[model samples]
Target: MSRIQANLLLTLIALIWGSAFVAQSHGMQELGPMMFTGLRFLVGALVVLPLAWREWNYLAGRQLALNRDDGLKILGLGMLLTLGAAMQQIGIKYTTVTNAGFLTALYVPLVPVLGWLLLRQLPHWSVWPGALACLVGAFLLSGAQSLEIGLGDSWVIASALPWGLHVLLIGRVADRMAAPFLVACGQFFVCGLLALIWGLLFEPFSGAGIQAAATPILYTGILSVGVAFTAQVVAQRYAHAADAAIVLSSETLFAALFGYWLMGDRLAPAGLAGCALILGSLLVVQLLPLLQPAKTSSEVLPIK
Candidate 1:
């Protein structure tokens, strides 16, 4: 995919993710987090079921369809994603929303380092400066006058490592698998099943616990993870990681905007400053085209 296409994908990913938070917050009002996650992902997977036949056909020519190893690889990816997601969900529950937002943003910077370690690809030097900017932004966005790591902060911060790892894994495997099929299908199949078993073994009464969260549940399952994630996989196929990260990072901005518009949350002065810094850093990374300038906002915003 061209750079233009990549930027557009990231933008769409950010928009979807940002909007989903509204659904998640609303859903959690009535449902338990784990159960909510499970059902929502299952909804997304069901959406992708129609594409499974296409995947089966595609894979049959290049690889085995009903093989143990193939199943294991996808399952492994699912397990890792679930672990990261569970950690993140728990982190958000404990920490202030401010901390969760910026902390999770660390995954963008963390990706380059993880890439270096796993793929033997040296990252750009500019990444370090961008990472530092992101760190300060997190500190500021957390709205803390004094630096004190609460238990919640620790969990959220720690979870970002796994989230970063998940991104790297996706980046590596996006080319190998049927991107939409794997993303949408596996959300329900892999994470859904795992969450279900976890709920049964540990907290079986989840359905009864969160029966009233239908709106959010349906929104997340059908729209956010199901549609947005499939789009992300398709977009990633076209965009570079750095460009993609820049676009998706807009989730923070979207969340803040939506929070203010929909939920009456205010963006403090410092918070806006942090947001600007993060946005600037993200934009700074896109100067790689040199002779050919990347397109403007049209490339960054996808109406679809």
Candidate 2:
């Protein structure tokens, strides 16, 4: 797929995830965070299992071997996914869908920074300004002017770190692996297994609670996890990680809209301004690379 197609796919994923935020919020009403997370992702894993098997068969027919290192990386991604998802799930219980949605987007700026720091993939100069804007926006959105944030918002903010790392890791994995469904399946299964273990050990279990959350679990599991995330793994193969983050961040807008319509979420003026600033910064960050003139091989100077 072309970059444009990849971006469009990411946008669709954003919509699914944004709407899924409402389901997630409702899910916590009936189930503990770990239990809800575990059930949804395990369902997701089952949904993807058939497709992953087909992919494995295709690879086998071609006599291609999956690398051991890539398998390890997939496991690592599962851990990050679990941490990020669990934190966001827990946070959504205390915060409005609007707040949770916007705060979760903290990963947009983080992707480029983490890329630069860990992978030595230098971001455009615009990244610093954009990152600053995102931080200020998060502050305003979180009501930090009162000099404190609620526990939910704090968890949402913390989730961004792992979320950013997850995005970067997916980019790396996509570059190395041709089987997107397999990658998605492995991560979902591992995350589901770990979350289920945690839930069983620490969180109370009730079949009625699961039944109460059945609709949400199925919606998020089938569409959000099964379809959207797998699509992301495929799309990122053709898109840059930073660029994909910006597009995925549009989910914040969708979340706000859905929250307002479905859950009666209304943001204060400060929160509105914060959202605008974040969206503007994302646009600037996304466009800066395209705006800058590309240096020719001769124009490029060696870094000491």
Candidate 3:
């Protein structure tokens, strides 16, 4: 797909995940964080199994086995995914959906920084301004005037590091692996299995609790994990990781809207201005490349 198309797909994923913040908040009302995370991701794994099988068959037709190195990389991705998801899930229980959503966007700035530090990949010049704008916007949208943070907000902030690394890893491996669905399946399974084990060990289990959270589990599992994440893996194949992060930052806006409408969360005037800044930053990031003079092959940096 073209870069524009990939970005559009990322935007859609953002919307799905934004709405999922509400579902996640509701889901934990009856279930422990680990239990809810385990169930939803396991359900997501099942939802994507058929696609993963097709991908496996296609690879077999080409006489290719899954690369050992790639398998290890995917395992690492699963660990990071689990870390990020678990922190966010736990944090949502104590924070409003609006706060969780905006705070989680801390990853937008983190992605480009991680890419540079770990892979020595330098993003386009425009990315810096856009990322700064996104960071400031998220801060304003979160409505925190002081450095002190709540426990839930702190957890969500902590999750940003792993989430940023997850994006970089996906961008690094997605094209080379050429099995986005399979990668999605493997990560989901690993995350689910680990979470389930953790939950069973320390958290109480009740079938009725699962039933009570059924709607949220199904919605997030099917849409957020199954469809949106897989699409992210595919889209990142064509899009730069930094660019994808900025585009996906739109989730903060969507989450605010959904939280206001569904969860009775309200944003102040500053939050509304923050929303406009986010939109402006997104436009600048996406449009700058198209407006710039085309670079020669040697002048272009390979997507990392």
Candidate 4:
């Protein structure tokens, strides 16, 4: 659709994703990180499978061959997503909600840089300034007190790398397949399968944790994964990868605001400044293309 519609879509996605952050954090109250993740993906996969199946009709006959490049690409993308989600969910347990929210949002800046190095294609000129602003916002938002990076901090760092890669993977594959199917079925299956293996092998899957997580886990499984992700599939289809990254990054703003409003967390001085930078960043990024007279949808219940 039009750019106006895209902005609206991204905004709604941001709001949903922001609210779900609280859900994800709460869901872990009873579930082990891995068990929670596995169960969520399993439920999400079941939710989206029918939609993905509808898209399969487009790939008839030999197009569906296992040896096809699309098959391999989709598989590889799924693996990276699995890695990112595992690190993020577990890392969230150790980090403050504020840090967890902004740290993960760093992937917005990471996308353009990774795309440049790997694809030999630089992002729009807006990316550099946006990255710097985001970095400053990150520093302030982090409240480092002297740049200390703890275990949880390190996990957040690790999570950014894969998430950036995940965006890159989606960008490459976006033009080649059914966006919804790739998002709903292909990538998710990979995530589900790998998480299943990880949970079974390394995690405690006792009934206590699983049952404890029943309500929150159920919230995460259905709304966060199932509904939010469907929005992402549709929305991302309408924008370029880098632009999509910025729009998705709006989650940081929403998350911080939501935390304060819902959890009684007050905004510190740094929080106030960080929030401004985020708002400024959003305004600049959104207006850049239009000011230059150039450039740039779904049930997409986007997650991040």
Candidate 5:
């Protein structure tokens, strides 16, 4: 797969996730955040099971070699994902909506920084400007006039670290794993297990509540978790982590768009400016590399 194709896939993942915000909100109406998260990911694991099985069968005759450490990495990814989700959900309870939105988008910048520290891979020069642009856009779009840090806001900020790590981890695992579908399944299952355990411990879960949130659960599980996440794993195999992160961050943009269209939400002048900045950042990230001279072999970082 080419970089463009990989980026397009990432964009699609962003779209799916962006639109699924509605379902997420609806699910919370009948279920605790933890309970909803657990059930949805469990459903996602089930949704991916057949696809993973088919992929396994297809590779049965091939000389496919599995890495000994892939399982460990996949498990780590699931744990990180669960932590990120849990933090965001819990943090939202105590923070302003604007704070939650802007802080969650902090992962846009965190991804490249984590990649540099952990993998020694520095992004292209254009990525910094794009990331900053996205950050400012998110801040403006969030409608926050001042910055404040409460416990909930702190949790949200903390979540960005794991989420950023998750992005780089996906790139590394995708580079090494033979079966993306199976990896995705393992991720979902592990995440589901953790979420379920936490939900059972702290949140009330009932069949009636699950039934009430069934449609939202199904949409998130099937499309957001099953399809979008699998696609992300596959797409990151071809794209650089930084590039993929920039594209995936566009989910915030899509969320704004969907809010305006579906919820009768209106964008103020600042919000409109934020949207433009985000769009400009996307163009910078996507097109600047093409305009610049190609990197020599020594300049390009090899995937581990």
Candidate 6:
């Protein structure tokens, strides 16, 4: 693919993912967060299984075996994914999609900080400024007067830590895994199963609820998880790292647009400012290396 085509693919992926925020919020009207999360992830798992199997078969043809250690790593990744997805769904129930989109972008800044703390690697100087901007943006967006943040925004903010950890884990294990698609499938299966158990324990399951939520669930599960993710995997092979990041990070903008157009959601001026800062910070963090004269190229962070 040409760079332009690759970039368009990435942009499409971002659009799909951004619109999923609206889908998730709408789905909450029919099903509880736990049930919705469980069902969507289960559907996602089913959708991706064939692709993963195809990759697994190719690896097997090369005489590669997925070992016990890789299995454990995949399980760990799944657990983290489950937590992040659960928090996001629960937060969406109580927050506007606009708020959820910008807040979720916090993970972009949080990743380098987590890498520094966990691996003892120093972040580039730009990371510090980007992180600061995100912190300030989050504070303003939270609508805190004294020190109290809204419950839903708090959930979304807290979810960023787990997401950061998930990225770090992927960075550590991705190069070692024989089949990336298979690893993704294993993690999705684990996340789906865990959410399913939580739903069974705490939320009532209803066929009627599932039926009502079908459209939203299908959008999030099949398009967001299955198609968009696969497209990202393929497109990134042909895209410049920084170009892909810039395109994909427009997800917040798309989310706000979708929310406004579809549900008439609006943010206050302060909240809008916060969203701008957060988005700017993400760009700085992603493009910083490219701006530096001595740096060869930018590193590509994995998409959530």
Q: Evaluated with TM-score, which candidate comes out highest?
A: 6
> Would you give me the overall lDDT of model 5?
0.71
What local lDDT score does residue 217 receive in model 2, on the 0 to 100 scale? 94
- How high is each candidate's TM-score? 0.80, 0.87, 0.83, 0.83, 0.77, 0.96
Evaluate all candidate structures by whole-model CA lDDT and list the values in order. 0.64, 0.82, 0.79, 0.69, 0.71, 0.84
Please write out the lDDT profile of model 6 over residues 72-188, one tens digit for every residue: 999999999888989988998888898898899898878878989989878888889998999889888776776788889989988898888998787567667747778777887
Off by over 4 Å in 1: 1-13, 61-66, 95-99, 150-154, 178-180, 204-209, 233-246, 285-304
The residue-by-residue lDDT of candidate 5 on 1-304, one tens digit each, is: 9999988988888888777665766677787878777888888989889988987787776856455677788899889888887787666565544345445666755666677778888776777887888777756655667774367667767888888787667756755665767777888888888888888899877889889999998998999888776676678778866677467767766766666676555767886787677667765655565455654211111110
lDDT (10s digit) by residue, model 3, range 156-271: 87888888898778755666787877887888888898998899899987999999999999999999888886677678778865567467767877888899999999778887
| Tens digits of per-residue lDDT for model 4, 148-194 | 75566568768888888887667557555645554556777778778
Best by lDDT: 6
Q: Point out the worst 10-residue segment of candidate 3 by lDDT.
A: 295-304
Give model 6's TM-score versus the native structure: 0.96
Worst 10 residues of 1 by lDDT: 295-304
Q: Which parts of model 2 have CA positions greater than 4 angstroms off?
A: 1-11, 231-247, 292-304
Q: Candidate 1 clashing pairs?
A: 31-210
The order of the candidates by lDDT, greatest first, is: 6, 2, 3, 5, 4, 1
The alpha-carbon lDDT assigned to residue 152 of candidate 4 equals 68
Instruction: Report lDDT (Cα) of residue 93, candidate 3.
Output: 91
> Which pairs clash (backbone N, Cα, C closer than 3 Å) in model 4?
228-301, 230-300, 231-300, 231-301, 232-300
**Comparing 2 and 3 on lDDT, the stronger one:** 2
Predicted candidate 1 versus true structure: per-residue lDDT over 1-304, tens digit per residue: 7879767766877877776666666665655556666777777778778787677777787765546655666777677767766666666556544445556666666767787988887876766788788777766666667886566556666766777776677544544554536544764578877875676566545455566777777777777766776676677667765566467767877766666677666657876777677666655544442213453222212111
Query: Of the candidates numbered 2 and 5, which has the greater lDDT value?
Result: 2
TM-score, prediction 3: 0.83
